[model samples]
Target: MTATDVLFIDDDAAIRQAIQQTLQLEELTTETFDNAASALKILRPDFQGVVLCDFHMPGINGLDLLKAVQQIDESIPVIILTGQGDIGTAVTAMQLGAYDFIEKPFNQDELIELLKHALEKRHLALENRVLKAQLRIFARPGPRLLGGESPKMKRVLSMLENLVDTSADILLSGETGAGKDAIARYIHETSERSQHNFVAINCGAVPENLIESELFGHEAGAFTGAEKKRIGKFEHANKGTIFLDELESMPLALQVRLLRVLEERKVERLGSNVSIGLDVRIIAATKSDLKSKSERGEFREDLYYRLNVIQIDIPPLRERREDIHLLFHHFALIAAARYGRESIPLNKQQIGLLLQHDWPGNVRELRNRAERYVLMGPVALDEIQSAASVDTPTPQSLSDMVDAFERSMIQNALQMCQGSIKDTMEYLGLARKTLYDKMKKHGLDKAQFKEDADHDGL
Candidate 1:
């Protein structure tokens, strides 16, 4: 355990001096209080150390001092050092929240060991409190996952509803910012484990060196700074769901450990021999193509297969154009509430501008734009055109300008339909063959546009 600030309370100066000298080797800061009244005056709630008080003091006994300390903050562990061997009184002290009791002439080794154990317990207790507080922030509904009148969306919601009963693993895949975490939370909230806990850990966020201990825990003395045996996310989410966002970023070595837990229903903490059972349902999400990664040897094939049991691919916001208006309205409403303003309108020009741009960052980008819209009002069309012109190729020749204009017109139409060739052709009043020729001349991949349209089930 970490060396902590310790306090010793006893009227016997010799005993106090002995304890102070013994603990000095451990580099623990110690304060000696000759009486309970003096100890009370110095005791503060922020003290992380344990208190060692003699059972019999001049005025208040050890049990009474423990009670007083607990009333201020029950978290601090109190150790009672008594000369008598009374089990009944010891039981009473235990009932009163005394951490542990030691008979007089306590061995330095034994005393140090008990103090280390008490410190570990205190550390875990404090950590749990902080984790619970952070969880409360995510307890409320997150950013909106709006839109679903299309068959694809309806089916997605139906699948989510079905998942509310079973403890089956769920896999979500799509472009970045597609709101995969939102769907994961929806399933967790509607599931039987809602009352337990829903722990979300981003595999891509943490450093590779620490990921294993973060997932499966670590034993005391396992490594440097492993002052105490720590409970990892798996044990923390014992009876609940564990959402692993960006699961593809997990290292192969860690993936092997994870696969074993998923298969054997148990996990062993790092540097520990014993295997502890787990009852957590895993929900893994990835923006990258896991199948591709598996084939490329970047991700484990068996792990991919395990996680892909119940897959739900969320379409990007650009593909799900029908949901654009709904998402915009939702985001606008949130912005209005946050800013304490009335409803702001997105006029026809604003709507047309939104329909023309391709959202590379998906729903997250769209929500950001909507919030920007609420704050900045409608953006100038000429400014957008000027921005577009800087990136797009400009031709000096009249013939080339005409060709560029034609390509730009077709591209705008394609973006409006989120790259649906059929819709683009219909909007442009052009034949499929002509659209094909124009796309070929512009060096465009017609298939890529068609893929997004098909992915959205357009």
Candidate 2:
């Protein structure tokens, strides 16, 4: 809404004409009316802008017009124009819901300023309605796949579809790059709450000090720089889903608050007197060994039990060798589209090499490698390893570090030959039985695990 559509009602044609000319110079759209009755007919809830009317009209007076406009829609601010020495009438107009009273022989500057303020308020009200409408679209289900249709991926999709309708809190456990977030998204997109928000927050990415406030919001003066009230994730996720990634990285204090919310169905916003009710279905994901963390007293035991009510451990890309070709094709096509280039198909050797490497960083690492390959031809083994290593932070102590390094190398060799001991040994420059012995020593299982009916033992 703009001040360009200002409507002026006055019995005198000259006065109405004068006001319109003056407003026209200010780049306003003006409509002059000799009678208030005709003006009321044109006035609507969708009126473009301000309504300026004369106080001493013959039929319906300024006060009567203001009352009628208010009856139609109270949101519209009606300004009453009075003649000189009509101070009592202007006061009466203000009492009767007139936004402002302008005396005749009014300064053009004053009228323009008042009209401008009213137009801004009207514009903001309309903008807020548009914004709320946009939010409704985001609350709906988002796109679910990057690509791929291998048997392994089919099983994952099957599991997601099976679990989507339930109200269970899912715990997605996987390696850092294993696409746990992708699986989480798939569940949310296919679930009953698909029409609601699916908000994701990285537990590890946020600083520990501000994590609580970021998740649960704060009131004005909650702390330094807390100048205004804020809504929290739990509140924002009402009747929706909240994905807490890197769940183990959340501080113990926050873990307690989260557990309480899960158990009691509410949360207390910081620096507030009251607790807010929440209806968010939580889907927490972790890349680390949560059992180990629980044992180390780094993660809360009660919280883990609560979250692990329905756990889904995602296998690394190397473990699902059959899916490599599918993943490669998926990434390749995505890369081509993103880079605006013709899609390039991978050779048998390229697929073989892709399957052979141990993707420590998981699906995310594979996607990055695919993008690199698309941009700069085939990537070298060292370059790919360096890329994966960027997220797989190095271990500190020598003994622990060496063990991790050895595990990675052995895992790579095993994956290279589809778990063939002889081929794996040749790749690792070791004997067949020696490779088997190392596999046993490292507690690496060669058995092919499948998602069974008793998968969660529920």
Candidate 3:
């Protein structure tokens, strides 16, 4: 639990010191400010504390300060300290959002009790904010999967929806950065165990020596530096789901123990004989083919079969070419909202470059580029073009080659006409509908290329 501080503001130096000393004896963290102005300067919207202010002061009295604090964060409780016969002023303070009021020469016990209640209210408000944020991440409809109209993506979404209610173990195979973990999370969030913990661990990240201890925690004194008993990921995820990313990296020795736990539905902590029953659903992900590894004797065939009850293979970004534009726009919108920036529109040339690129890093790479576009704006175009040019491969099919040539010609005409639709259509010698259709198909936005009307052209 985080300790909440008390901010005390009073013009009188003696009153401020006395209150500070009293709070110190009660083991409460307190900050004393001489005036309301100084106190207001330090208060923030996310402040986890309560405020105490004198009813009358030289500048910005307690009532004004109460309104200001409420504007910053209504959750922070502000208590007013009034002198004797100031009952009318105290009533006004309450109307202006003061939490409570205490008369001068107030009893120490009463003051402490009021403060304790205020602190508890502040703590609950902060906790509710955090939980609401978490719920928003999983409860939103559509775009949670970050998928598109591509057939491959549609199949993935269908599989996820079908498995949402099942307790079957799942195996997700995909190229690195293809959003395997995201699929795992989507499954958990939409499943019956949505209310339980969704524990995730990257098998390749933990060191070989400590991986066992991390997965099946240890009793106190199980090993050096093991000062206390720890709950393992499996136990933490009991009655919910556990996602093991990079599962191919787990050692063969651990695989044997994992298989036993899966079969028996229980785990034995290191240095402990007692077996703890578990109701954890395992979702394992890997970039490598476990079947091939099993054939090569690198992986246990039995464990592979156990985990492969249901398999979901996510397509790489290059294979889902049509989804690139939709995904880029999606990530751009998210970045814009997060960083308080406008989503920059992509010009014909930039859109062409995005579609032609091989995206070896897949969806993750596209998301990063979108974030950079939001942060750096037009400057990111040069970087995107450079990366795409380096990775763009030769067209292997006639249709692909024709599409590429058509996109290039359209981009050239749009640029030459300074983004005038009529001029571009005449320049390309194409019908108006044909030009518009191609522009939409190629994800080109002519507005991005438009020069200021005051100036004819660059």
lDDT per residue for candidate 1 within 224-340, as digits (tens), equals: 989999999998999999999999999998999899999998999988999998888899999999999999999999999988888998877655555555556556655655666
**TM-score on alpha carbons, each prediction:** 0.54, 0.52, 0.60
Evaluate model 1: give its lDDT. Answer: 0.74
Candidate 3 — which pairs collide? none
Per-residue CA lDDT of model 3 for 1-458, tens digit only, reads 32336899888899888889988776566898888998888898777779988888888988888889989999899999998888898998888778999998899889988997887687657645653553467355322455455567878887887898999999999999888888888888888899999889999999999989889989999989999998899989999999999999999999999999889999988879999999989999999999999999898999999998899999998776666765776677567766788886676567777777778898888888888999998787677677665664744576864575576567656644546577788877899899999999977667544421111100
Where in model 1 is the C-alpha error above 4 Å? 1-144, 380-458
Q: Which ten residues in a row have the lowest lDDT in candidate 2?
A: 449-458
Model 2: residues >4 Å from true position, as ranges?
A: 1-155, 379-458
For residues 1-458, what per-residue lDDT tens digits would candidate 2 score against the true structure?
A: 22234788899888888889987776556888887889889777655467888888898988888888988766677888887767797898788777888887889999988986776565545434443543453244532344332345556667776788887889998887777777777777778888898888999999998889888999999999899998888888888889999998898888888999999889888998798887778999998888889989999988889888888877776655545555554555456655775546554446545655667777777767777777777653356545454544433455644454455456545533434455567777898677778788766544311000001100
What TM-score does structure 1 among the candidates reach?
Answer: 0.54
Q: For all the candidates, what are their Cα RMSDs to the real structure? A: 27.6, 25.1, 18.9
For each candidate, the alpha-carbon lDDT, in order, equals: 0.74, 0.71, 0.80
Residue 159, model 1: Cα distance from true site in angstroms: 1.7
Q: What is the clash count for each candidate, in the order shown?
A: 0, 2, 0
